[model samples]
Each structure stands twice: as structure tokens, then as C-alpha cells.
Target: MMPMTITEIAEAVGGTVTAPFAGEHAGGVPDGEVARSATSDSRLVGEGGVFVAIKGERVDGHDYVAGLGAKGAAAAIVDHAVSDADVTQIVVDDTVEALGALARHNIERRRADAGKPFTLVALTGSVGKTTTKDLLKSLLSTLDETVAPVGSFNNEIGLPLTALTVNADTRYFVAEMGANHVGEIARLTTIAPPDIAIVLKVGVAHLGEFGSVERIAQAKSEIVRGLLPSGTAVLNADDAHVAAMRSIAPADVVWFGIDPAHADEDALTVRELTTDDMDHPSFTLVAANGDTADVRLAIPGAHNAMNALAASTVAHMLGMPLDDIARVLGEQRRISPHRMAVSTVERDGAVFTLIDDSFNANPDSMRAGLDGLARWGAGRKTQPYRVAVLGAMLELGGDEQGLHRSIGAYAAELGLDRIVAVGSATDAEFDALAGALAEGACTAIASRGGTAAVDWVHDADEADRLVTSIASEHPGTVALLKGSHASGLSTLAERWAPADPARR
Candidate 1:
């Protein structure tokens, strides 16, 4: 973050200075005492960093402000001043809003720096936003310094905290915008407006909150609407809802997708797209200018082909060559945790491939993950025992049961050897949703003449026992873990494939 004095920060956030450090002046902190960064998490606060004390239901950040001086913190932004603490305090009505203001001030300072101007690229979607953000970060970093969020930090507080991390030498800021409502993305846009905006897809991830897919489309379009007048919009041409955004875009739009029907001379499209046995996509990245490069993504999933193309489009717009884009893309072997993350697991002398896509789930992403599983099984020399341990996909509106069942049917239709629908043992509602999934799979199996086994377990423990049983019986087995965050399947995935601490 650009350095800002305590007085400048308090003025930026409309806050009052209180609880000045003992060594500091009574009126205010001196100009030499400045905060170099901003963070809401007290544990992550560094010396010379400004801590934003946000009050949450479980934890009140104001409680930690009194100790900032001992940690060498420059100051604390809180709703109420902590008189006990020796650190400088900027008292405000709302610390979250103050953090946003500080971030906005930091970004404006960077933009006005003249010597080091940075391009801010923002993206939003129902799915693939983080994966695409990681891809774009990788591609952009190959050219110059880039800053992006840690994970799915795309909300109000997350976006601002990410924006504040930008410094003078940072050449690119890849902001991932996410919202369950119509105005959330627009609100975030006010904090860090993008020079180039991207809309990945308009799917049904947050159908319950937004009410309809059309409303979700409208919510996703805010990124394009929030772009600077001279900015560029990178949109997915494959999704009809996303494609329609071109009509409402505030600036020139650049299209990227796998579909040729939506492509024009200026759009980037994929050709001869295909995924390997592990679901790694290899495609010809074709540009509007006739420049082409063969891109073989190391990440697992055919769905990522569009994501890669979207990142390539942004890099291309930023003057990166197609060869460089392809090279950077191919070098990315992983993304944020638990999204189509592939690993090996051994249980009772049996081994299997684990596709840990348990980060979060929706109908679109579930189907995409199942497709990857089907391809992984089909590509093997010998047929591997395929099992899909699916948990309930939440926030799907009133048709939540139908959505769960449809996912089950999709796995059955894919000829998976086993379908385990997992739900909470203690939660009756989630158990019913899992039952619906199993019922759909059972119906599909009975009618389709497949020997697939469908079972609805109460929780991840039961699902793990069943998968381990299958692993013991079959030496070559492949398991897919897909679920919403509430389903807790990600925990099971972590147990199955614990992250390598050396790499972390």
C-alpha cells in the first residue's frame, strides 16, 4: 500500500484520532509515522500496518486494538477508541467502511503516482472466478509484478483489503468481484474500479439469494457497468447471459470462449479443444489477429478451457504475446485449494485418484466436475471404479432438491460405479437433500440398466467409510468430492489429501 500518514488516513476515512501512542505528539501522529498497509485481521497485522477493527458476531476486532503499539503497528481504525492501548487510534463510526475508504485512497494515490501506473483488472461470475483470477495472475506476473486476492476474497471487505495491498511498483491488480445480490459488486467497484473488467459466466451458483438466473446475470454485469469509460470488457461469448452483457457494457468489449458461433474477428476463441485422461485441456489458442499458440493446461478440467481463454484475452489486451500467454498458462499446475485439485490417496492397500472439488458446489460446477471424473475414468487403459461422493449444493432456491437430484442423475448417466450422496447426520434438512440426490441416481440406474450403486449417507464420515470400503475392494478406484461449503465435504477432502506443508 502507498504510505499514508495517520492524519491523512483519519481524514480519508472521516475518523477522529484518539489514544495517541505515548511517544507520539498529543495533537496527532507525525508525518514520518505512517501506515504502509491495511488489514482487518489482527493476526496478519504487521508493524507500520494499520489495523481495521471490524466487529463481527463471533469476534470484535476492537478488543485487540490496545496491544497494537507493542506489535509496532502504526495505528488502529476502530468504531470506539481503546483508551488502554498505547497505539494511535483512528476512531470511526464503521471500521469496515473506513477500511474501504483507506483502500480507495491508496488506489487513488497509486493511480496518481504517474511514475508507476497500474492496470486494474476485475472479474466476476457464478463459478470459475477464483481459478480464472489465479490464471490471470500467473499470466500477468510473467510480465510484471501483480497483486491478487488470497482465495475467494471477492466480497465487500475482501475486495478492499486486496486493493489496499497494491503498491507503487505493482503493475497489475487482479480483483475478483463476487456477490449474491445485485448491488454488492457495484459497491465494490466504487472502491477499485477496473481498467479492464471480465465476466466469466452467469450460472446458478447463488440462485436462492438472487431469485433467478436473470438477476444473477444482472449482478454479474455490474463489473462491466462499473468499468471506466475508456476501459475494456472481457466477456464470455459461450454463455448467452454473459454474451448479452455486450449490449449494456459501458466500454468496448473483448470476447473469449470456446464457441465459434459467438466469435467475431476481434474475439479470442479456442480450437481443437480436448482434455487428457486426467482432464487437462489441450487446445489451440486462436487470436483475432490470426496469431495462434498451442496451450496444454496442467490444471484438471475441460471447463478450464474457457477460463484459460479468458485470462489469455486479458493478457493479450495488456500487450502480452500469445506465446507468452500460452507458456504461462501451461505452467500453472494448480489453483486455489479444493477446486478440481487432483491427488492420490491410499487406504487399506488400495489406491485411488481423488478429484477434490469440494471447495464449493453448484449445478454447473458439479456437472463440470463429474464430466472430469468421467473423462478420467474413460481415458484409463483399464476401467477404474468411479465413485462420486456428492454433498448437497446449497443456495439453489426452492428447487434445491431437484438440483441435488439432477446432479445425482448426471453422475449415474456418466456410468459412475458408485454414487454417494452425503448430508449432515444431525441436520434433517440436509439429509433430505442427500436423499433426493440418491433417489435420482437410483431411478436413473434402474431405468438405464447400469449396475451403479447409489447410497445416501448422513455425513462425511459415513461417505469416507464407504469410499474406503470401495478402495479396499478395488485396487484402481477414482473418487470425486463435490459439495457446497455447508456440506463439509472439503474437510473430508483435506483428510484424504492433506496438503504438503513443505509446499505451503
Candidate 2:
């Protein structure tokens, strides 16, 4: 958000300034110039920033106009009426949409000037986008100054916001793109379109909006569509569905995989797995040119091995040495507080290891979690139960129920000690698991009250209560908490783990 004018913002979003300068207009203010740097929901406003007041299904931003004035907002972009005592205001049909346009405009201005900037890398998928972003940041940071999408800012608004975060000093920009519908990735790609695009894989994530995995792949492939003509596309060679994404790119394609079977087939791959006594994984890194070296992973799971391979491919394409790339990644931290966060829980008699994967889950990630759990839980004997507080995986659309049922069947087949389910899909899962699973290992329809007919997920307390009740009913468990972003299943895991009661 370089400094711009209020009149320019009005031009940008097709909003009109309802009032001229009512408040004291400063002498140095550019005729209509107003600062529209970042989006803010706070009641307080900055001296020059354009404050967008949005209306939701419930709350209206119109109510906060004067409140914005009280906080010295340079100009208020409003949808409804503003009565009295105002600075400057732009009235629009909707503030949220205005905010989106303003963001897109801001990024386009910077990108149009990217002649002086470095190569851009964009990562997208149902799972591991954040982890891959972190890995790229780690590897690229060794090469030059880097800018990355912070946290989970990978949406329509988040994409532009991340682009705005980049400046002239950044040598590399890593953008994490996320979507749930057909046009989101395409829309996001319009901003921060990458020089190098990484697609983790396609699975049942966000299936609600897009309908099927094929549609999801099409939506994600928009990253390539949005790329510069000479950019590279990096893909998951192991994902059968994602195998075709390379064709979508106008430039070169870089391939990465974790399967040793694919290791010799010319794709860059990482193999040679060894789990430590602590059960964390270490592996060998194999480049596309047939070079190989051993590198220990800070992140757990076979999925992360694939993640490292993807990171390695990007680094190799960017001209990093084979050996140096492995060493830097071998010591970097796994994306924090996400899956494989090692923690311990105290029971009546002994300690049980707890691995928190509560950020979010999809079909691909759920299977990865089960495999990781198998590695961690296989040798522990005192484990009373291998617990999974599985919640409704949203966005599967027509396939939601079937996907949940399949996961349930898979969990039972894995011989997990117990399963606790939330969401409507679990009812389908329960029906699938009941006959195939032993009596004690599987449970279903376990929302707040355990009613069979309820279809939605429970609250944090409810999810936590489910965990407590389950633990009380059967103690000494190793719990794996997984669900979609909206699941709030992290609350359940947090409550069960050792936390300040106030925090809980």
C-alpha cells in the first residue's frame, strides 16, 4: 500500500466520497490522496488509511463510521448512511468487496513494477502448502533475502495482502495460494503469480465448493495459468492426479517424489527412511541429476519427505548446491504447532506420547497421519488406545459422506485402538466401521450429546469434553486430533494436553 489518494480509491472501487473534507483537511494532503495500505477490522483508524466498513449477514460496518472517525480514520469507505461528525468517506454498495478490489489494485501496481524484483514462488494444495512455504523459506533464505506469505494468509484477500508485504528489498517471494471454489486460485493467481509454482497434490479438500478432485486439480492448475511465460511448474510426481499439471505450464516442469519406486525414473526424489528412537524420520535426498545425499528431517511423516523433495527441486532449479540444500533443511524447524508437534501427556500410571495434527485434515493428509502414527505408536506397549478425534472434513460436496466412510473403514483396518468422530460424515463412517472393526476400537456420532441424528461439529468445549469423556472411559491414550480448518478440533487437543486452565 504505497500512498495513494482517496479520490483514487474511489476510482479504484467505484465508490464515491459522500462528503468533501468535513474534518480539518491538512495542507500537505495530496488533492484526493489517501493511504490505503492494509485492511483493518479494528474500530480505530489510522491518520491516512482508508477504513472499509463491511456489512456481514449479522453485523453492519455502517454502525462503525463515527467510531472510525473517533479513531482518526483518514477516510471511511461505507455502504450505509453516515450521519454527522465525519472526516472523509467513500460510500459503496459493499465494503468487503471494495476491500478486495483495493487489495488487488495495490498488488497489481507493485507487480507491474516487478522488473526490479526477484523470482516469485507460489505453493498450493489441500495440505502442506504452509509447510512447503516454510521449507522454501528455509532453503531460499540460505540463497538470498526472502519474503513469504505469513501464517495462513493464502485466500483472495490473503494473497493480495501477502503480495503487499513484499518490498524492494526482498530477493525471493514465496506465496502460498489456497482455495475452496472454482475461481479462487485463478483470482489469486492474478496477484503474485509465480515464477515457480509448486502443487503438493489434489485430494478431497474443499470438495464442497468444487464438487470433485478433478475440478480441484483444475482450480489449482490455475497457478500455472497465472504464471509468467518463462516460469517453472513443480509438481508431486507421486500424486497420480497431479501428474498432469506439468502440461499446464508454459515453461519447464520440475518433478518431486518420495516413493523410491519413482526415485530412479528421472524425477528428483528423497528416500532412505530411518525413524529414531524418538520416532522422528531421517532420509536421503536424491536430485534430478542422479546426485544423492542423506538429510535428517525436522518434520515427521512420509508426506514431509515429499515436502522436502519439492523444496529441494525448487532450490536446485534456483541453482543451490545439492549438499548445502540438504544440510540447511536437515536442521530447520518443521512448520510450528502443526502436525508432529511432540508433546507428552501424563496418565494414572505412565506417560503417553501425543502428536498434535489439529491444524486441518483431508483424505490425503488423513492417510499420511495414520502412517505417521503407525511409525510413532507401533513400538509403544503401554498405549491404552491410539485415539483420533476425527471431525467432519468439510468441502467434499457430493463425495463428503463417501470419503468419511472410506476413512472410517481405513482407520478400522489400520487397527487403531479407538476412533471418536464428529460431523455428519461420521454416521456414514460408523456404519462402515461397525461390522469390520472390533467392538472396542471404534465409536461414532460422538458430538456433544452423542445423538445419532446430529450432523454438525461440536464446539471446543464439546470436542474437549468428548476427549475427556473418552479418556475417562478408557485411560492412557495417544491421541491424533484431525479435522478441516473450520473443525475447531484443535480446541479438543489443547484441552486434553497440559495447558493453563484459564487458557483452556
Candidate 3:
């Protein structure tokens, strides 16, 4: 963040300085009294940091204003004034709006100071935004000082906080934009308009909120509409919904896809796609200029190959040679947690493979994860028994039950050795839907005379117990835990794969 005095901050956010220097002010807050960083969490406040007090569902940050002085905060931006704390206060009508205002000011300042104006690249999609953003950050950092969010920080609050982190030396700003409704992304574009926009795929991840696939497509395309006049739109040519966005983009369009049939002469295409025993995809990356490179990803999933192509297209446009782009992508490992994170655990003389893709789930991501697990199990020398401990995919709307059942049936069809559906067994309100998911898989398996077993558990504890028992009985068992945020599958993964002391 750029250094700004309390006076400058007040001017930027339309706030007033109220304490410590309210009456002692020599015209305005001293230029030396500056905040070097901004945060909404008081616990993260450092010396010379400005704390913005935001009221959340459970905790009101205004309640912590009295303690900022002890924590070395330079000033507090609050909706109300605090009398007890011996700290400078910037009183604004709304802290969130003030935060956006300050972020816009910082971005404008950085652009004016940059010798080469920093490029803003924004991406939105149903499933691959975070993973693709991580890949882009890794590739861009090889060429310039890049600023991208930590993990899944794509919403309103997270986006502005990320934008504010940019400074004069920052050359690339990669913003991951996400939305649950129609106008969310459009509002975000007003904060940090993109010079380049990427639309990965239009899927059913937020079907509940938007109500239909068409509405979801409309929400995702807001980023492209928000692009600058001279911006570049990098689109996924394979997705019909995403491909249609070319008509509305007000800038030059570049395409990336795995299927050659979807590619035009100017598109980056992937050919001869194949996965290794661990399910890591390798393919020939053919760029727009016909320069080709053999690319293999360290991440374990065939789905990630498409994400790699999206990142590679962005890197190629930014002047990274095709060979260098492939090398950087091939060397990159998992940057974010709980997305295709593979680990081994030894317990009671039994070794198990844990594929934890439990960060968030929808029908599309769930299918990709299951496919990766099936492939991985088939390629193992010992023929590891595959178990899927999946939680309910939330916010699927009126067809939620049907979608869950379809996912369950799909798992059975994959010939997985076992399936465990996680949900609240005791909660009468949730049992119907959760039970349907379990019954759907069991019925499908029985109908096909498949040997795969199905189990339904109320919570993560029961799911973990069942998985441990299966691993004990079958030493080479491999399990995939995929679920939405409410399922708490990520907590279970941490229990199974705690950090190793030797590696630490």
C-alpha cells in the first residue's frame, strides 16, 4: 500500500479526523502521521496501519477501536467515534464504502506513478478462477512484480483489499472476480477495471443464486464488459456460453481451448492430451503464432490442463516466449490449498492415498475430481481401492436433490470401491436430501450389480471413521474427499495430512 497521511485518507474517503489531532491539528493531520497499510481486522493491525472498522454478522469491528493504539495502529476508520482510545480516528459514514474509495485513490495514484502503467488482468469463471489465478501469478512473477490475491479472495471486500496492495513497482495486477448475482461483477469493475479479461467456463457452480445457466453466464460476462476500450479478452473457445461472449467484448479477442475444432487460426490450441499414472495432464501447447511446446503440469488433474492453457495464453500475450511459458507452468506445484492436494498417510500398518479437493464443489468440479481419482486408482501397481467421501453440493436451487443424486449415481458408475456421503443424519430437515444422495448411489450400484459399496454419514467424524476402517481392511485404499464449504471436508483433510515436522 502507498503511504498516505490521515489528512489525505480523509480527503480520499470523504471522512473527518476526529481524535488525538482533532484540536491540536496545525491545519490538518501531520504529513509524518501516515499509515503504510490498511486492514479491517484489528488483530492484523501493525505500526502505521489504518484499521477500517466494518460490522459483520457476528462481530462489529467498531467494538475493537479502543485497542488499536496498543496494537500500534496509526489510525482507525470507524463509523462511530471512540472516546477511550488515545488514537487518531477517521470517522466515515460507512467503512466498506470508504475502503473502496481509498482503494480507487490508491490505484489511480499507482497508475500515475508507474513508468510502465501496471496492467490489470481480471478473470471470472464458475470453477477454475482461483486455480487459474494462482497459475497466472506464478507465471507473471517470472516476468514482473505481480500482485494477486492469497486464495479465493474474489468477492467485493477481498477484491478491493487486493487492489490496494499494489504499489509503483508492481507491474501486473491479477484480480480474480467472482459473483453470486447479476450485478456483483459489474460493481467490482468500477473499482478496478481490467486491461485484460479472462472467462474460463460457464457452469453450474452458482445455479441456486442466479437460477439458470444463462443468468450465470450474464454475471460472468460483466468482467468483459468492464474491460477498458483497448483491453484484450482471452476466452475459452470450447464452452459455447463463454464463446458467445466474443460478440459483446469491446476489445480484441484471443481464444484458448483443448479441442482443435473449437479453435480459429488465431487461437491457442492443445493437442495430443494425455495424463500420467497420477492423472497429471500433458499435451502439446500450440500458440497462435504456431510455436509449439510440450507441456506437463505438476498438479494432479486432467481438468487443470485447461486452466494451464488459459494462463499460458495470458503469459504469451504478455511477451513470455512459448518455451518459457511451458517450462514455468510445468515447474509450478499446487499454490492454493485443498484443491487436488495429494498426500499419503500411514496408520495401523495401513497406507492410504488422500486426494483432498474439498475446498468447494459443484457438479462439474465433482465430476472432474472423480474422473481424476478413477484414473489414479487404475494406474497404481497395487490397484488401490478407491473411496469417495463426498459432501452435498450446496446452493443448487430447486434441483439440488436431483443434482446430488446424479453425482452419487455418477460415482457408482465410475466403479469406485466405496462411496460415503456426508451430511447431517440427525437433522430431520437435512436427512431427506442427504439420504437421497446415499440411496441414489446404492440403488445405482445394485442395479448394475457393481461391487462398489455406499454409506451415508451425518458428519465428518463418522465419514472419517468409515474411511479409516476401509483403509485398514484394504491397505492400498485411495480416498477422494470433495465437498462445498458447509461440509467441513477441509477440516478432515487437515486431520489426515497434518504438516510433517521433517518437511517443515
Candidate 4:
């Protein structure tokens, strides 16, 4: 974050400096001291950092204010004072509201100091928001100082924290907007409105929260609506719902997709796309100006091709050459962990290809991960055995059971050799959900009338044991682990892919 004087911070948040300077500078901090960064987590506070005390469900950050002095913190913004601690205090009515105010003030300061306004890019979708953001950040950093959120920090508090990190030197600010309900993205756009807004596909990611697919599309369209009058809207032409956003876009529109029907003079399109044995995609990137470059992504998955096109289109609009964009994308590896991460595991003289896409799951991503596994297994020289370890996909609302059943049936149709459904039916409240998934998968496999085996486990440990046994028996086995965050499938992936001693 850029440096801000203590006096300036208090004024930005409309708070008062009450301690450590009662008589100095009219009860304000000394003018020489500055806050280097802003964070709510006390553990991240440094000597010149500003700590915002927030009240959470399990813990109150006000309790941690007393220890900041020993940590060398510059000041703490809290709802109340801690008389026992020797820390400087900025008293505010609400710390969360103060945080937003401070971040907005910082952004305005950056714009004034930059002399020319910096570009603000906002992106939203049901899936691939993080991967596309990472790609855009990589491509933008080659040309200038870029600031993006770490992981999926795309919500209200997370978005504000990321905005505070920007300074005068930052030329590009990539804000990822996410929503589980309507108006969430609208609120985020008010904090830092986008000069360029990209809307990926609108799918059934948070169906439970929004109640229907139409509502999900309505929520995703808020990003396009929040754009500046002169902003550019980057949209996916293949998605009908996303394509319809052009009518509501306040500025110029740039379309991107693999379908030829969406191609135009100013569209960024893809052609002749194919995935390798490991599911890494390669395609010819054609710019609207007729310039073309072949892009081979290091990341594994056919679905990532669309993500690449989205990032490339944004970069092209920002004055990056087509060749440079393709070159940098080829050199890019996995930035965020647990999203279609491919690794080889050696155990008991057998090698298994592990596709760790267990970070989070919705119906769209679940289908994409399963397709990757099918393609990877089919491309093997010896025709390796295929195994799918799926867990419950939550936030699916009333039709959650039917959705889980359909996913199970789809996995069966993929011709996987084995299916392990991970969940327990022991809990009275969760039994219907878990039981439906397992029963649906088993029933589908039975209908196939093949040698493909299906098992239902109550926990990750049982699923891990079964998967280990399968890998041990079949040397060239390929396995996929996909589920929501609460399913504990990511933990199973970590157990398989332990830290390397050499890296440590």
C-alpha cells in the first residue's frame, strides 16, 4: 500500500485519534508517522501498518488491539479503546464501514497522484474468475505495475482490502467481482468502478443462493451495468445469456469465444483447439485485426481455453500485441492452487496421475473436470484405468438432490472405470443430500451394465484408502478429486501431494 499519514487516515475514515498523542498536534498523531499497509488480521500487522478491528462470528478483533503495540503497529482502528495497551487508537463507530471509507480515499489519492487515470478492470462469472484474473495480472505485469487480489478475494471486505493496496505507480488494477446473491457485485463496483468489465459464462454455480439460473445471470450482469460511460465490456459471445448483455452495456463491447458465429472484425476468437494427453489445450488465437498467434497453455484442462481467450482479449484491448500475449500465456503455469492441478504420485512401485480440482465445485465445473479426466485417461499409451472421487456439491438449493443425481449419471456416461462418492448419511440433516449423491451414482453405474465399480464412503479417509488401493493395483491409473470446499476433498489431495523435501 502507498504511504498515508496518521492524520490523513483518521480523516479518511471520519474517526478520531484518541491515544498516544493527547496533547501533541491537537490530539492527532505526529505528522512524521505513516501507515505502510492496511489489514484486518492482527498477525499481518507490521511496524507501520494500520490494523482495523472487526467483529466476527467466532472472535472479536477488538480483543487483539492491546497486543499491537508490541508488534510495532502504527495504529489500530477500533469501535472502543483499550486503556491497558500502549497502542495508538483511532476510534470509529464501525470498523468495517471505516475500512471501506479508507480504501475509497486511498483510490482517489492514487488517481490524483498518477497524473493520468490508471485503468481499472473488473471481471465476474460463475466459474474461472480467479484463473482469468491471474492470467490478466501476469500479462499486464509485463507492461506495468499491476495489483490483483490474492486467491478469490472478490467480495465486499476482500475487494476493499485489495483496492487499498494500489498506489500512484500501479498502472493496472484487476478487481474480481463475485456474488452468491444479487446486489453484491453492484456494491463492489461502487467502491472501484471498472473501466473494462469482462463477463464470463453465466451458469448454475450458486443456484441455491439465487434460486434460479435467470437470477444468477441477473446478478452477473451487474458488473456490466456498473461500468463507466466510456468503459469497454468484454463478453463471452458463446454464452447466450452473457451475449445478451451487449444491449445493457454502457460502453463499447468486445466479444470472445470459440464459436465462429460470434466472430466479427473486432472480436477475439479461437479456432482449431485441441488438448494433449494430459489435457493441456492449444489453440490459434485470432485477433479482430486479422493478426493470429498460436497459444499453448501450460495449465491442464480444455475449459481453460475459454479462460485464455478471455484474458487475451482484455490484454489486446489494452494495447498488448497478439504475439506477446500468446508468448506470455504459454509461459504461464498454475498460479492458483487446486484448480485442475495435475501431479504424478509414486507409491508402492506404482505411478498415478492425480487431477486435483478439489478446490470448489458447481455443476458446470464438475462437468468440465470430469471431461478432463476422460480425455486424460483416453490419451494414455496403455489406456490407464480411470477413477473419479466426487463429493457433495453444496449450495444447490431444493433441486440439489436431482443435480447431484444428474452429475452421477453423467460421470457414468463418461465411461470411468471406478467411481467413489464421498459423504456420510449418518447426520439426520445431511443424510438426504449425501445419500442421494451416493445412491444416484451407484444406480447409474448399475444401469450401465459394465465392469465399472462404484462405492460410497462416509468420509475422506475411506475414499482415500479405496483410491490408494486402486492406484496400487493399477500402475497407470488416472484419478480425479472434485468437490465443494466443505467436502474435504482438497485435504485428500494435500495428503497425496505432500511438500517436497528439496523445495523445503
Ranking of all candidate structures by their TM-score, best first: 1, 3, 4, 2
Candidate 3 steric clashes: 0
Using alpha carbons, what is the TM-score of model 3?
0.95
Alpha-carbon TM-score of each model against the true structure: 0.97, 0.80, 0.95, 0.94
lDDT (Cα, tens digit) per residue for candidate 3, span 1-504: 888888899999999887653333323444478788888878889898888888999999888888676677788888888766556889999999888888888878787884676899999999899999999999999999999999998987888889888877899999999998999999888888899999999999979999999999999999999998998889999999999999999979999998898887777789999998778899999976778999988888999999999998898889888889889988877668889888887655667888889999999999999999888856656787899988878778899888888898999998889988888755653555667678889888878768888888887788777888899999778889898877667778878874441110
Deviation from native of the Cα of residue 137 in model 2, angstroms: 2.9
**Which candidate number has the best lDDT?**
1
Over 199-255, each residue of candidate 2 has an lDDT whose tens digit, in order, gives: 988877877788777899898888888888998888787888787877778987777
Q: Which window of 10 residues has the lowest lDDT sum in candidate 1?
A: 495-504
Across residues 269-348, which tens digit of lDDT does each residue of candidate 4 receive? 89899998878899999876678999999888899999989999889888999999999999887668788877777654
Worst 10 residues of 4 by lDDT: 21-30
Q: Give the candidate number with the greatest TM-score.
A: 1
Between candidates 2 and 3, which one is better according to lDDT? 3
> What global local distance difference test value does model 1 have?
0.87
Model 4, which residues run further than 4 Å from truth?
21-28, 347-350, 425-432, 500-504
Ranking by lDDT: 1, 3, 4, 2
Root-mean-square deviation (CA) per prediction? 2.0, 5.8, 2.4, 2.6
lDDT of each: 0.87, 0.67, 0.86, 0.85
